[model samples]
Structure formats: structure tokens, C-alpha cells
Target chain A: MTPKISQFLSQKNPSTPCLVVDIDEVELRYRAMQAALPAARIYYAVKANPARPLLDRLVFLGSCFDAASWEEVDLCLSAGARPENISFGNTVKKVSAIKAAYDAGVRLFVFDCVEELEKLARFAPGSRVYCRLLVNNHGAEWPLSRKFGTTPESARTLMLRARELGLDPYGISFHVGSQQLSADAYEVAIAQAGSLLADLAADGLRLRMVNLGGGFPIQYRDDVPGIAHFGQVISRAMKIHFGETLPEILVEPGRFIVGSAGVVSTEVVLVSQRGRDEGPRWVYLDIGRFGGLAETEGEAIRYMIRTARDGEEVSSVALAGPTCDGADILYEKSCYTLPVTLEAGDRVEILATGAYVSTYCSTRFNGFAPLAEHYI
Target chain B: MTPKISQFLSQKNPSTPCLVVDIDEVELRYRAMQAALPAARIYYAVKANPARPLLDRLVFLGSCFDAASWEEVDLCLSAGARPENISFGNTVKKVSAIKAAYDAGVRLFVFDCVEELEKLARFAPGSRVYCRLLVNNHGAEWPLSRKFGTTPESARTLMLRARELGLDPYGISFHVGSQQLSADAYEVAIAQAGSLLADLAADGLRLRMVNLGGGFPIQYRDDVPGIAHFGQVISRAMKIHFGETLPEILVEPGRFIVGSAGVVSTEVVLVSQRGRDEGPRWVYLDIGRFGGLAETEGEAIRYMIRTARDGEEVSSVALAGPTCDGADILYEKSCYTLPVTLEAGDRVEILATGAYVSTYCSTRFNGFAPLAEHYI
Candidate 1:
């Protein structure tokens, strides 16, 4: 947790099962990315944590936004972001949502297949449209399926179609995947994009931008390669692949910007070992899978946890949320260890939960309220 | 879809991505379970789509409730249910919640460990508490972990401890699992609980109840053992184990009571095959895993889907939700087939989605609102 969040939790002691986001930390991460990639325009992914405070900070920093929906476009606009500064980033979108975003003056949008391209052509007429290309998800913790993106061969045809349909064939975009572990993942995608760009140029289609979609990783339970390593790797890859005649660089970083800026503070509701003589103790917290820690699905994203008794005796434990549903478990096979003396009412803080958490909570599953939020 | 729900949808033409629940059908299922298990008490598990209208209708039919949280307890009471008719069924609960339930005159609760039993003894003093036993989740689509129950040996000790600590050692409880398919699953669990009850009696503690916690099946994409089949198997098992001196029989049916009573009405957002010549079509809907079809995680609860063009030629398709997140996919490998003519603006109905769909929705995962609810 950031010092700002630590001080807020210590002083305010907001109710358990709430998130505390350090807004200053968000601005700091934004500047760090800006400084690292000086030429690249950083589009803060609004879907990560679309809180007004976070958006307001980014808006003040003149940060561009990558909105996933019409609602998110409105959120960015409400925070004083310019319409031209936001890109409708989700590949699969409703025609109605496309119309809404267009009517709201948003021009840039992303599409993968011909159907979505057709929707944008008809509803978001004459808009800047980019085709998303499918690439390898080699080292992502939350790897995306073929649910999105088209083949580079298909993307070439689709971008050509976008131009034919009275749309600006703006650029190309592709996601390496969320929480991407390898910088080489982006390298591979960039190479694919470069080859496609070179082929498109021969067909008299010169795209102006290369939208490097968000997949930036942050510190969790394990030590991840810092952002500097990713910046250096991306810069070198761009130089190697697209040399002198460089296109506009656009990077969407969601987790890297806001992930470490927040923490989830929960109370231990119950702890059990199920009467076993030899097994990990089951630790139950007020917040769980349905409660907001959804990235823990399949034990994919492990978050570092802290307690008031952290320096005390410890034992191996399985962690779960407080719900009646069996699927509400957060981490089981991950082998998380906690203080043996941990009991009901003890405060516990899950670190680096700032992004993709507050909004993922169920409205009121099992009659429990959604996780409350505090932006310091 | 039920005739009532189908009629409601055709007449109402509500907004897309909404759940239409037939309250009359809910009453019918409640009464059907009551008729099948005449000697058993039907406690409607409130976690499964606890819309106020659903709860109000069940209350009017004189149905008792199995609440997963203190807020659910209040929901039951607000719906005209008597305090005595509500049982705090979730084993993992907060001490403050226990005190609140006790102060509200709730007398029955469930616990699986010593720490929880002590909390009950202190906060809910003299309340009737049952020990939840861990049973094999064989033949269950959504199998539970060792998260909410104790072994029979541990249960016996906890029950004795309950008696010694000014609390009523009410009985033993075990959940076979959600969407349980095999009739023999209940038989094995009943046998386990029967032996435990016998052991507790040998300690001079006369337990007064046996909660065969709800696992009654409802039809989905695949056929399951009907509620009648589950009721008969449970009745026969209880008879073979306890004979004539049967304790109070309690069954908490959440999904079975409401699963088939609701249908999710959604609109097709986009369809893509990723420019592949031969592959399953990728059909994206207005709702998905985070949009309330969370049971689709691991593709467990497969709900039968119907489209307006159902009679048209069909093609194998992968279903997904309209979100920016990659994990928002509903069914990719489950081999769902849809009308080849299905396109954007086409209405689709996800059947047997009444139980766990509405409340499982993320509040606003990617700027998309939670699944709207329409109870008739």
C-alpha cells in the first residue's frame, strides 16, 4: 500500500471490505509512464477503475482515455476530457453504443471483424477506425481467448474495407493480454503489426498510428519486471521493427497506472481448518470472488496480503470470501500463508488491488453490499 | 421458457439484457417441492436471485428462508417472513452479524467450526445451531470445496461443545452440491449425517433437526435428475438411516426453486468467425460472465439458449459477453449452437437463468450496468 493509503486507513479506519485508492500515486504513475515513453501518447484505460477522482486526476494531467463503452466515454467527458482525446477501445461493441459514442463526439474506435466495422461505418460514420489483430498471448496471467481480434491477413482486408465504407482507416491495435509477464510478448505483436503495416503501405494504405493496447503488469504477490524494463524493451522493439519512418505511438496502460495505487481492506469473518489434523487453515474474509477480487479466478492473479499480526506466527492457509456460494473462493491452491493467530474482526489489507476491482463487485450478491471506495 | 415468461416478454418487450422472472412459476416450484417432500421444511435460499418481488411472493406462499447474510435476513423480514421462519444458513458469518440476527429474533444458525460456535455462544446466546458436514460433491456441476463444512467427527465434537456452551445443539447439515445430478449423492450424504447424529445421541445430546441443505436440480442445457427424483431419494435415504424416529427435516432449495422460473433476455452485440474459413462463430451478447452469468466460469451451468430465429439453420458458435475483459466469455468449448442467421439487434433468451443470474452481476464492470430485472 502507498503511504497515502496507509495513513488514510490508519486515520479514517473506513469500514472493512472497502477500497482505498491513493490519487497522488495515480498521478505519479501517469507521469512515470509519460517520462518513460516520451513520444507515446498514454491513453488511461477508463475501464480499469473509472472512479471520478481517478479520471479527474488523469484529465488534469492531459491524459488521453481508452474507453470500453459509451458509459465510460461519458465518464471521461464528465471528468472534462476532450472527445477527440478518447478512443472507443473494445472490439465487440453494440451498434447502439457505437451510435451513442458517435453522437457524443467521440471519433476514434476499434473493430476486429467486418460486422463491427460495418456497425461503425453506418452508426459512427466517417470516424477514425482501427482494426485489432490477433496475436500470441504467450505470457499473460489472464490470457485472452480468440473471443477478440482477427488474423493479420483478415485485418488487412478489414482496414481496407473501413476506408471503402466512408471511414478513416486510422491505425491498427492488438492486446498482448492482461498482466502480461513477458516484454517479448509485445515485441512479437509489434513485429506482426509492422509486417501488416508494411503490406498495407504497398496497397496505398498508410495508417497513421499503432495503438499498442493495454496489458501492462503491476506488482502483485510476485515481483514483476518494473515498468522501466517494459519501456526500454518496447522502445528497442519499435526502433528495430519500424525504424526511421515512425508512426504515432499510442500506449494504453490500465493496471500499471492505477493498480498499485489502491488497496482492499477487509475484515476476517471466520477461519477454519475443517477439523483436519494436517491441512492448510481456511481463512474467510468479508470480500471475495464475487466481492471484487475477480482476477483471482483460477488463481491467476495472486495479491499480496497484510494483517495487523503479520510479524506474528504464520501458517499455510487458503483464502475465501464470505459468501454461501462455493465459487466465492479467492485463492485455494495458491498456498497463501497468514498469521496463525488471525481471527474474526482482524483487519486485513490486500495490496495492489487499485484497478479492475471496485467495479467488478456484484451489486448485492448474498445480500452483502458492494465494496465501498475511498479516494484519498 | 415457461409460457408465462414467454408471454411477458412478447407483450412487455422490455429492454435488452434483462431478466424476466415469473413469480407465479416461483410459487409453483415452491409448492411442488412442498408436495414432493411433505415432511420436510422448504427454506428458500435467498442468495439465488433475491429480488424483493421473488421474496415477497415466496413469503405469501408461507415459504421459510435460508439467508446467506444478515442483509438477506432483513430482506426476508421486509417481505413479510416471520423471524422464526428465517435461518442464517451461511456458516462463515461475522460476529456483528450474529448479534444483529439474534437481536432481530432469529434463533437458527449454522456453524462448521469451534471459533464460529464460540461467536454464536457469546453473541447469539441460546440460539439453535446446526453443524454443517463436508460431503463428497460427486455428480455435481458446481462442486463445493471444503469451505463451509466440518467432518462428521469434527461435527460431533462441535455439537457437544454447543450444548455445553448454553446453545442448542440443533442438528447436522450437509450440502451435496449445487446442480447435483445423481440421486445417490444425497443418499451417501444422508448416511454420513445419520451416523453423526447417532454419535451425538450417544453423548446424551438429542438433536432435533437434520438440514439436508439444498442441492435439488433444475433443468439446464443438459437434463438433470428432476426435483421429484431428488426428493424421493432423500426421503428414502432418511427412512433407511433414521427409520421412524426422524428429526425435523429441512431442505434449502435455491436454484431448484427458482432456476427454471426466469429467463435472461439479451440482444446480439456482434458475431465474428475471425475471418476463418472453418470455425465456430463468435457470438457476443449484451451480457456475459461478469454480467451475471458467472456460473459460466469453467462452463459449469450450461443454460439452454433460444433465439427468435431458432427454426433457422444452426451453426456451432462460441458465446461471449459484450465487455472489454477477455474473461467475460460465457461458452467457448461447451459447443453452443445458434441460428446461422443470428445478427445484431436479434433478441436471445438464456433459459433457466432465474436463480443465480441477476444478483451475480458485476455492478458496472466495464461501464456496463448490472443485468436489469423484471419480475412479473
Candidate 2:
């Protein structure tokens, strides 16, 4: 946890299993992104912990937004972001949602296939629409589903179809994936997008934008390359590919700007060494997968655990949430060790939990209330 | 969909992505369970789907409840269940919750370890408590995590400790796991419980109850042994193991009583044959994993989806929810087929969603509302 979050937690000592976010830490991360890629406009992805205070701070920093739903678009607008600064980022959309977003003055949109582009042309007529290209999710920890993005062969046709249907074939977008660690992943995708751009340029279409769809990694338990490193790599890659014709660059980051700024305070509900026969102590917390740690699905994004018993004698332990479901087990195979003295009622701080924690909480599954949130 | 739910959906034309439950169907399943396990007291596990109306109907059917939390116990009580009819079933629980349940006149509880038993003794003194035994998950589709239950040896110690700590060492309980397909699973667990019961009896502690915890399966796609088979197998096993000392048998059935009683109606948000190069059609629904189909994690508990275009030239398809997260893909590897003519806005009925669907929905992961629930 950041000092701001740690101090707020100590001072407030809010309810257990609640999220604490340092608003200033959010601004600092936003400024870091601005310094990393000054030319690429940062459109903060709203789906990752869209607490109003965080959005308000991002808006104050003049950050644009990439919203997956009209309700998220409403959240951004309510946070004082202009509609012109918001991008309707999801490809699969309800036509009603498309119309709702269009009527709300959000002109920029994203689509991957002909049906979605047609829906955009019909509902958000004359809007600037971009096609999402199917990129490989090689290095992302929380990689996006292949359900997104059409193949480039399909995207080429969809973009032309968008223009014929009276929508502007604005650009091309590709996500290297979420929580992407390797800078080479972005470089390879940029090369694919550049080839697609050349293919479209030969077809007499001059797309004016290139959305480097969000996949910026945030540190969890492992060391990762800094944002400046990614920024430099992307800058060099774009120049080498596009030559002098640099289109408007936009990067949508959800986890990076806010992930390190938050901490989840959960109380140990039960600690037992006698549960498992093979013998790793099972520690149950007030929060689990259903309680908002959805990213822990597959034991992928392991959060750095800080306990009051840290620096004491430690032993390997299995972790779980306080729900009845079998899937609520947090860490079993990953070999997590906690202090031997840790027991019930002790607070455990899950770090780098700012993004994708609160909103992912189940609505009272097993009768536990939704994970609470606190913005400092 | 059942005749009632289908009629309700056709006549009412409710909004897309809603669960329509036929209340009578629930009662029918309850009656079937009553007939199947005539010797066992039925405790409806409320964690599966704790909607008030369902609980109210189950209460009207004279069903007891096995609640995971005090809030669930409260939900049961608010729906007309007597406090004595509720069991605080979760092994891991907060001391405050124990106090609340005990104060509410709840006298029965389950625990797996010394710490939890100690908490019950302090907060819910003199309560009838059972020790949860960790049984191997052999034939269960949704297996309970090793996080729950205790080693039979640990349970033996905990039961003895319970008697010493001013709590009743009432019985032993074990879950064969959720969606258990084989009747032999219960037989194995019963033999284990019986041996433990014998060990405790040698110590002169006369335990008078044995809980055959919930895992009753309902048909999804593949046919499995019905609840009657499970009932018959359990009855034979109990008689053989206990010989004339058959304890007060209790069976907790969550999914079996309610799984087939409900169907989720979602709209086909987008259908793209153009997206995937490998060529299974991509069907996007208004709802996905975060929208309460969380049982779809790891493609376990695959709900049989019925579409309007079924029986009209089927082809295999990849399915996903409308969220921007990559993990939201529902079934890419599973060979699920749909009509080639299926398109956007078509209603798709996901079957067997009655038990675990609505309550598992994320509060609003991507600005999408919780899956709407309607009981007919």
C-alpha cells in the first residue's frame, strides 16, 4: 500500500474487506502516464473501479475515458468529462445502448465486425467508428477474451463497410492484452496495425487515428517494466512503422493508473491448520473471489499480501474467502505463506488492488454484503 | 423453460437478460425430494439462490434452511422460517455472526476446527454443533474446495473439544461436493462418518445426528442419476453403516430443489461469424460470467442454452458475455452448437440457471445491472 493509503487506513480504520484508494496516488500515476507518452492521449478505462472520486480526479487531470457501456459513459459525464472526450469502447453492444450513447453526444465508437458497424451506422449515424483487430494475447496476465476483435482480413472489409454505410472509418484498435508485461507484445501488435493501415491506405482510405487499446501492466507481486519504457518502445515502433504520417495516438489504461493506488483491507475470519490433510494452513478472509477478487480466477493475479504478523515466523498457507462456494478459494496451489501468529480478526492488506476489485464484487453472494469502497 | 416460464416469457415479454422462475416448479422439486429421501429432514441451502420469494415458497413447503451467514439466516427468518429451523452451516464464521444467530434463537451450527468451535462456545453456548469432515471430491462437477471441512481425525478432535467447550457435539457432516453425479460418493462419506461416529461413541459421547450435506445434482445437458437414486443409495448406506443406530438424518439440497425451476432469458447482443478465423460462430449474450453465470468458471456447470432458432440447421459456436474482459468468454472449447441463422436480439434461454444464477451476478462489473430476477 502507498503511504497515503496506509495512513488513511490507520486513521479511518474503516470496515474490513473494504477498498481504500488514495486519490492523489491516482493523479500521480496519471501524470506518470502523461510523461511516458506525451503524444498519446490517455483515455482512462472506466470499467476498472469506476468510483466517482477516482473518475473526478482523472477528469480534473484532463484524461479522456473509454467506456464499455452507456451507464459507464454516464458515469464519466457525471464526473465532469465531456462527451467528446469519451470513446464508446466495447465492440459487442446493444442497439438500444448504441442509440443511447449516440443520443448522449458520444460520437467516437468502436466495432469489430460488419453487424456492429451496421448497428453503429443505424443508431449512431455519422459517428467516427473504429474496428478492433484480433491481436494475440501473448504476455498479458489477465488477457482479454478472443470474443473481442475481428481478424484483420475481416476488419479491412468492416472498415470499408462502415464508410459505405455513412460512418467514418476513423481508425484501428488492438489490445496486446490486459496486464501485459512484455513491451515486445505492443511492438508486434503495432506492426500488425501498421500493415493494416498500409492495406487501408492503398484502398484510398486515410484513417486519422490509432487507438493503442489498453493492456498496460501494473506491478502486483513481480517486477514489471515502467510505463516510460513502454512509452519509449511504442514511440520508436510507431515512428519506424508510420514514417512521417503519425496518426493521433490514444492509449486506454485501466489498471495502470489506479491499480497501485488502492489497497483492500480484509479481516481474517478463520485460520485453521487442521482442515487440509496434506497440510497447508487454510486462512479464510472476509473477502474472496465472489467478494470482488475476480482477477484471482485461475490464480493469475496474485496480490502482495501484507499482514500485521509480517516479519514474524511464517509458514505456507492456503487462502480462501468467507463464502460457501467451492470456487471462492483464493490461493491454494500458488504456495502463499503468512505469519504463523496470524489469526482471526487480524487485518490483511491486499496491495495493488485499486483496479477491478470493488465493482467485480458479487451482490451479496452467500449473504455477504458487497465489498465496500473508501476514497481517500 | 417450463410451460409456465415459457408462457410467462411469451405473454409478459419481459426485458432481456432476466431470470424467470416458475415457483410451482420449485415446489414440485421439493415434493420430489421429500418423496425420495423420506427419512431425511430437508434443509434448503440458501447460498445457491437466496431470493426472498424462493425462500418464502420453500418455507411454505415446511423446509428448514442451511445458511452460510447471519444475513442468510435473517433472510430465512424474514421469509417466515423459524429460528430453530435454520442451521448456521458455514464452517468459517465471524464471532459477531455467531452471537447474532444465537440471539435470534438459532441453536444449530457447523464448524471444522478448534478455533471455530471455540468461537461458537463463547458466542453461541449450548448450541447443537456438527463437525464438517473433508471427504474426497471424486465424482462432483463442482467440487468443494479443500478449504472447507476438516480431516476426519481433526473433526474427531474438534467434536470432542466442542463437548468440552460448552457446545453440544451433535453430529458429523460432510459434502460429497456440488453437482455430485455418483451415488457412491455419499456411500464413501457415510462410511467415513460412521467410523468417526464409532470412535466418538467409544469415548462415550452419544451423537444423535448425521448431516449428508448438499450436492444433489439436476440435469443440465448430460443425463445423470436422479435424486431418487441418490436418496436410495444414501438410505442403504446409512442403514449399513449405522446398523440400528441410525441418527437423525439430514440432507441439504440446494441445486436439485431449484436448478431446473428457473431459466435465464438473454438477448443475443451480437453474433459474428466474421470474427474468428478458426470458424465456430461467435454468439455474444447480454449476460456472461460476471452477470451470475459464475458457475461457468472453467466451463464447469455448462447451462444448456435454448435459442429461438434451435432445430434449424445447427453449427458449433463460441459463446461469451457482453463485458470487455477477456475472461468473460463462456464456452470456447465446449462444442456448443446453435442455428446458423441466429442473430442479434434473439432471445436465448439458459436452462438450469435457477439455483446459482441471479445471486452470483457482480454488482455492476461493467455498468451492466445485476441479472434481473422474476418469480412467476
Candidate 3:
């Protein structure tokens, strides 16, 4: 077990299938990121584990928020974050949400298409807007394919359109992808953004900001470079591409800020074999794909699981969530090995589940409650 | 569009991205199942769609409930279902849930392991327990692997253990599979269960019940045999396998009875393209995997999608949800054709989404509300 989880379990015996967020670790990660990228303003993405305690702690530590919707804006505001510190980051947003954000004194918003620009012009008039530029997200663990962002030409057009509609097209943004592993991806995306900014400057549109959208990866089962490494790479890329005219930089980091801070303590409901005695043992947990571990879909994001019975003989077991639905199986092909003595009621802590858990949990599936969350 | 959806739209203009459940169709399906399966008692699985309105309707129509947890048992009881008419169907259950169910006067329960039998004995002593038998689910649309059920040898051991532990080992149960397409699957499973019953009888243990667990398929994209066909096949299989000593029959149908009865009306959030003009158009919906269309995970179960602009020019588009998460994508490889003119705010009704949609909805992800249920 990770020292964080071990320490947490020692403090409190939370009920099974509960998410424990260590606020101390979250503050540590936030400070680390802030220290690493001193030039860039960090807008903590709120969509990732939008638990009140985490938000409140971040706010108390002078953190900005990257809100995806009006509801998130309200959450951040309720958590005591200044509206000026919250950016409406989602490009595709409802007109009503845009209006609500505007009413709540949020001025910074993002847009990719003309319709979105039009919506912002109507609802959030005179607000600062960022155009998302589409980039190749080849090596990212969670590659976003043509969901957000626009082409350089489209970005230019949208910016010009924003100016025409009396909206401030203040910056250009690009997401390398979620859990992006390659620093070169950021280098390429930054270079592209720099070129676009220079081009817009040539056209007499003086854009002042560059939003490096979140994708900074955290250690799950794989080794990743520290926040300093990402900061150094991004700083070098911006300097090399933009020359002396380095635009004001903004960073949105979701998973990196909170991923390692949360530990999910789930209980083993059943550990049984299928077909024959020699077949793979299936370990059923109280939580599954629907219960907040939706990231385990397709086994794309493998969480490091540690059984409470540490050091006993280990055997590979196919892990599943306790749901009547067959699709609730978490890991079948990519199985986890638990201690051989592990059985019903044994607790297993799934480390690095802080981000994208609480916010992603389904209300009630198969009568299983959404993952209960506890904070330390 | 399906006739049901068209009729629904014609009557009321509900907000986009809402689930419209045809309670009339639910009643019709229930009556049809009752007419077809005269020997079997139908226990509607509440997990399929635990909307209070549907539960109340089912209860008013004299339907039994197959509850998976205490919450579901409470939902059934609140909907006016008698405690005696509800069965705790989930094999891997929490001890507290078991105790609560027992306290609520639930006597019928299902178990597949010795540990679960012990849990039952401690919490629900003397209650009638059914041991689930493992069977091949090769051709099932939603194949349950080692998550549920046990081998014949294991079932025999568990049943014997149940008796020793002071629990009534009253029946044998087997789920062929959810959305099982073949009638032969039932024949084979029933034969296996019959052999197990005979073996138990030879040991002087008289099992009094046989549970043909849910997995009956419904018409989506492909044509399926009606409820009558499944009923006839099940009846024949029981007669052929059990011979003269047919035990009391019980059926748990989740998807079949409710799948076709509900239609999900989702709006096109955005209709845009990828890298080039030649790339396939991506249609973003108000709902996605997290929004309650979770069955679309791995593209396992396909729901029939129809845009309001039916009979118009058609174009294949990659569908996605409005969430910022890339994994919220519904279909990309298996693209669906919509009216070429379909744009933002255009309504598209997803057929047969009633069963799993509402129950699986996340509370708030990306600030999108759970799919709102509207019953007619």
C-alpha cells in the first residue's frame, strides 16, 4: 500500500467502497506545480473530482479554477473561489450556462466554432474568449479525437469573428490530450499556437494569452516525468517558438493536481473461481465501472490496486464491480494480482483515484450507492 | 423514428436529452409475459429501471420484484410490492444489506458461494436460498463471465453448506445470459440445472424451486422472437429436463420487459467534422456513456438511434456526448446515420433505452444532469 493510504487507513476506518481524498497531498501537488511553472497561471480543472472539500482546500490555497459549466462555476464560487479566477473552459456549452456564467461575473470563456462564438456574443458579451487549436494527440494515454479545438485557419477566423462581435479573443488554447505522456506533443502544440499568435499579430489582432490545456500525466502504473520536467519543457518550447514576445501563459492541470491525492478503499465482496478450479479467480469489489471507476473502461487507465493483506502469496485475479450487469467487469484481460489469502471483507486501496472519480460516479446502479467520499 | 417516440414527441415537447418511458408499453409487455409464461412467476428486476413511477405501475399491475439490495427492496416495498413478493437476487451482497433485507421480511435470496451462504445464515437464517449454476454464455449479447454463478460442483457444495449453516437451500438458478439470443442456451442451462436437482435429490435434499434468471432479449436493431417464443421454449425445456417432477418456476426479466418500453430523446449538442472536410461528421449528443448510455461501453449493446428528421437525406456521423472527457464518446467506429441537416438542438430518440439508462446515470459529470425521466 502507498504510505498515503496506509496513513489514511490508520487514521480512519471508512466504510467499504469509499473515496478518501488526502487534502495535504493535494496541497503538496498544487504547490509543486505552482513552483515548477512560476510563469504560468494554474487553473485547476474542476471536472476532475469536484468534491467540495478538495475545491475548498484549493480555494484556500489561492488556486484558480477551470470550470466546464455554469454548475461548476457555482461550485467554485461556493467553495470561495473568485469568479475572476474561474475560466469557463468548455468550448461546447449551453447558451443558458454561458449566460449564467456571465451573470456570475465570469469573463474568460473558450470557443472553437462560430456558433459557440455567436452564443458567447449573445450571452457573455464583451467577455474574453480563447480559441482552441486542434493538435495531433498521438501518444497521449487518453487521446481526444476531434472533440474540442479547431484548425489554425478556423481559429484565426473565430478570433476575427470574436473581434467583429465585440468579444475579446484574448488567447489561443490547445489540449495535447488527457494524460499526455510526450513533452514533444506540447512542444508541437505550443509551436503551432505561437505561429497562430504571430499570424494574428500580423493581421493586427494583438492576442495576449496562450492556454496550455490539461493533459499532464500522473504516475499510475507507469513512470512519468515530474511537474518540473513538464514546466521546463513548456518554458523552453514557448521561448524557442515565440522569441522575445512570450505571451502570458495559463495552465489547466486536472489529474496531476489531484490524481495521487485520492485513494479509493474498496472491499472484496467475493473471491471465487470460474469454470474449473484452475481457472482465474474473480475478485468482486463493492465498486465497479459505474461506481466512479469509469476510467477503467477498456482498461485504458489501470489503477494500482493493493490488498490489505500485504506480503502473502499473490495470485492474478480478474477484478469486477458488484453489479448485476455483466459490463460492470473492471479488469478481465489485464488482471490484478492480489494476495492469495484475500477473501470477502478484505479491503483493497486503489491508489491515484482522486481525479475523475467523485464527479463521474453514477447515482445508483444495481442499488449500489455512488462512491462515498471522505476527506483528511 | 420509432412509432412510440414519434407519438411521444407529437404530444409533448419535453426538454432535449430526456428519457421518455412509455408506461403503457411496459404494462403491455408485462401482460404479454404473463400470458405467455403461465407456469412461471415474473419478478421484475428493479435495477433495469428503478424510476419510482415505473415501479409503482409495476406494483399496481400485480408484479413481483427481483431486488439486488436493501435499497431496491425498499423501492419495491415503497411502490407497494409485498415483501413476500420480492427476492434478493444478487449473489454478492453486503452483510448490512442482507440484514436489512431480512429485517424488511424478505425470505427468498440467491447465493452462489459458501461465503455468501454463511452471510445468509448469519443475517437471514432459515430463508430460502437459490444457488446459481454456471453455464456457457457464448452467444449472449451481454455475456456474464466469472462475475456471477458457480460450477455444478461448487453449487452442490454451497447448497449442502447452506443446509448445514441453517439456511434453506430451496432452489437452483441459472442465467443463460443477458440479451441471450439463442433458445438452445436455455435448453442447455435448464438441462444442467435439472441434473443438479436430481443429484441433490439423490442425496435426500428436496429442492422445491427452479429460477430461470433474466436475460431475455428485446428487439433493437435485430429482429428477436417475441416473449411468447421465449416462454414456450422455457416451458418445453423445463418439461423435457425435469421430467415429471417440475419444481415451482420463477422468472426474472429485466431488459426484455422494459428495454423496448422506453425511448431516450437526446438533442444534438454539436454537429461538426474532424481534420478535413472529407472526414466523417461528428454529432455530439447531450448524453453519452456517463450520462446513462453506459451499455454503449465497448459498443457491447447497440441501441437503435433515430433523428426527428426521418426520411430525409442521410449521412453517417460519429456520435459523442457533450462531456469534455474523450471516453464519453458513444460511437465513433460504428457510426450512425442521421439526417444531413441535423444540427445543434435537433432531437434524436434512442429506442429501447428504458431499462439501463436512468439507473446508470451519473449525478453530475461535466455539469450535465442525469438523464431526466418523463413517464407517459
Best by DockQ: 1
lDDT of 3 by residue, B285-314 (tens): 888888898877767778888876889998
Per-residue lDDT tens digits for candidate 1, residues A123-217, read 99999999888889879998874678889899999989899999999899989999999999999999999999999999999998998888889
Please give the lDDT score at residue B49 for candidate 1: 75
Q: Per-residue lDDT for A40 in model 1?
A: 94
lDDT of 3 at A363: 91
Query: TM-score winner among the candidates?
Result: 1
Top-down TM-score ranking: 1, 2, 3
Cα lDDT over the full model 1: 0.91
Q: Per-prediction DockQ, in order? A: 0.85, 0.79, 0.56
lDDT of 1 at A146: 61
In candidate 3, what are the lDDT values of residues A124-235, reduced to their tens digit? Answer: 9999999989999987888875577789998987899899999998999999998888888999999999999889989999999999999999998778888889889999
Model 3 TM-score relative to the real fold: 0.94
Provide the RMSD of all predictions against the true structure, rounded to 1 decimal: 0.9, 1.3, 2.6
- TM-score for each candidate, following the candidate numbering: 0.99, 0.98, 0.94
Candidate 1 ranges beyond 4 A from true positions: none
Question: Fnat of candidate 2, please?
Answer: 0.84
Model 2 Cα RMSD, Å? 1.3
Candidate 2, residue A327: lDDT: 85
DockQ agreement of candidate 1 with the native complex:
0.85
Alpha-carbon local distance difference test for all models: 0.91, 0.91, 0.86
